[model samples]
Target: MPTGVAIRDVREQLFDAAERVLLRDGRNALTSRAVTTEAGCAKGVLHRHFADFDAFLTDFVLDRIGRIDARTGALRGSAGTGTVADNLTAALTALFESAAVAIVGLITARDELRARLRRDLPAGVPVLTEAAELVAAYLVEERDLGRITADADVDTLAAMLIGTAHLLFADRFGTPPEAEGVRRIVTTVLVGVGPRP
Candidate 1:
């Protein structure tokens, strides 16, 4: 590999490469060499940016979690406008469509990564936990706008949605579950919460 080629935005490049490797090869296949190879940079490039392989993986997981944080604003903005089911369907679809499930798989597969993440996270699985938090935040917005029931347990509901969505998206060889299929799951979970107002 060429040693002198300049790679702009090396951190993002490595993150993207790691995500692709995680999604395509699963976590066990992810390694410093594989990531650097996929990113078209020297393995030393990864080390220079992160302390170690697990550090890279920890930041990689946090980076994806930060992405879920980024989506919260737009999702919250949709609070009262669309049908609750529609809003939720879109949100959950967007969450899983990214390398979320793959990242979750990566975290689960790496004990060291999980330990590093615990310093900041401390509870629940990293990606899925934040996914549920964002969903819960959106549900709170909807409830405030009267789109969801006043009595609805938004936190539990959000947790349930994330769990169910994880199951639906988990283990797919490649093709994601259809949007319609996702919508049905969303609607079913929201059913007992009361009709959308």
Candidate 2:
């Protein structure tokens, strides 16, 4: 005797509750019982919508990434013309800022979930190497437009930026000062290649 309206309402409530649990308690606290209690639904409600916890976690990560991407896209038109170093630093900083919560979610995901993420990452997921290549292309474009110094090696500088961001945000080394880290990245990359004084 499950009404369609009731089922849909329950599903939405459960999902919203699950999101709160994730934000508040991290991955370790994500359980069907927790979600059910938060949603004020029977525990079986979660299983009805999601095959398992892993599937729920996967969907959560993908949804967060989509939200972050949308926020980053909002900054596109207003990105001012600047030296390659300046533009790249602004872009990276904005991306990180917009993505902080999602980044925290990724950081706190459980080992099993992390392993699943590694195995199930979408083909289009931007890894460091691919990101560096894309950045290198952008640098080449910037150089041709005379926004970057003539001596800059676009590939190397892009690789350095990618590597630095990965270290700051990915691996465990304690969080770096956001502004200072961005400045250091720009300075290190632009030191030899920037316009001569």
Candidate 3:
């Protein structure tokens, strides 16, 4: 809206505004008008940067997924330092954050956005698949460090973690799982996979 605003700044502001609207008012309330109003910018700003509302939604959803990936990807750095349960809990918690869950709902509720994402993303897996791979990679690194049992099926463990988190996030009306709960889930799931004490 400002006369001298940078394009990147505008896009970031729009994204932030859209996220706020989606989180506060649910997926149905996310529109170019709502985003622009929240961002204090012209409605055309979204269209200027994205092809349509679906494109904007796709970018917003992908951005959230990218953030989750980056967060989980960093777990590799903490691979052997902390208890495997603690580290895995941290990654799973990051995946189920309120905003991330909200974006998941937004994308799922909009067929156009989902379709666009499928077309744009590689292998039709979207970023969630990449996130699982990142988690699996972290598990492999921990195994290499002898923190986890070498026999652990890292891919299966990663999928189980992702699937559980997805269920937790999708059930919005239920009491959300806390960090300790996540720790318990990870501990239970890793019983056979963790190194013998």
Candidate 4:
């Protein structure tokens, strides 16, 4: 909102405020006014940066997806440092802890926003698919290091992990699975994939 401030900085601030509102008060509470008020900016600031509320929402969700993808990508560097199951649990845990789950409902509730995202993003795959690919790549790295079995189906394993993360994060009544629970899920899935003793 301030003069001479970078647009990226302003957008980041708005995004952070929006995420806080969504996480604290749920998806319905996320409004331009709410985000601006939380960000300490003028009510018009959101509209100034985005064409409309739907656009802002689309951007916000996409931003979160980007972050999730980046986190999965970073898992490559940690390939052999920890137990493969532990490393995967850590990645899945990070995805669960993100605002992705909270915003997913918001995106799905509005068809227009969802359509807009599909239009803006590449036609091939959604962000979650890309995330799955990242996980598969990490699994491959582990297999190459002899951490996991060579015959493991990394693609199927990646999809299973992503689905598990979605289920764990989407739980409304119960607390989401913690790191230990995630580790358990990963270990269970890797029963055939992990190296034999």
Each model's Cα RMSD: 1.7, 5.1, 2.4, 2.8
Kindly list the per-residue Cα lDDT of model 3 for residues 14-100, writing each as its tens digit: 888988888778888988999999999778777889998888888887787777777776688888786888888888787777476
TM-score of 2: 0.60
CA lDDT of 182 in candidate 1? 93
Q: How accurate is candidate 2 locally (lDDT)?
A: 0.61
Instruction: For residues 1-197, write the lDDT of model 2, one tens digit per residue.
Output: 24343655765576678767765676568787888888777777677778887676666555555555554443333233555556676656655554444445553456655666666564323333345555677777766666567777888887788667655664333454476678777778777665454
TM-score of each: 0.93, 0.60, 0.88, 0.86
Q: Rank the candidates by TM-score, best first.
A: 1, 3, 4, 2
State the lDDT at 135 in candidate 2.
68
- Which structure is stronger by TM-score: 2 or 3? 3
Candidate 1, residues 1-197: lDDT per residue as tens digits?
Answer: 57888889999999999988888888878999999999989989999899999999898889888886676447777887878888888888888888888888888888888899999994999988887888898898887777778889998999999999999999747578999999999999998775453
Clashes of 2: 0
How badly does each model clash, as a count of residue pairs?
A: 0, 0, 0, 0
Sort order, lDDT high to low: 1, 4, 3, 2
- Residue 5 error for model 2, in Å? 5.7
Better of 1 and 3 by TM-score: 1
Query: Whose lDDT is higher: candidate 2's or candidate 3's?
Result: 3
How accurate locally, in lDDT, is each candidate? 0.86, 0.61, 0.79, 0.81
The parts of candidate 4 lying over 4 Å away from their true place are 1-8, 122-127, 172-174
Instruction: Report the candidate with higher lDDT, 1 versus 3.
Output: 1
Better of 1 and 2 by lDDT: 1
> Cα RMSD (Å) between model 3 and the true structure?
2.4
Give the number of the best model, judged by TM-score: 1
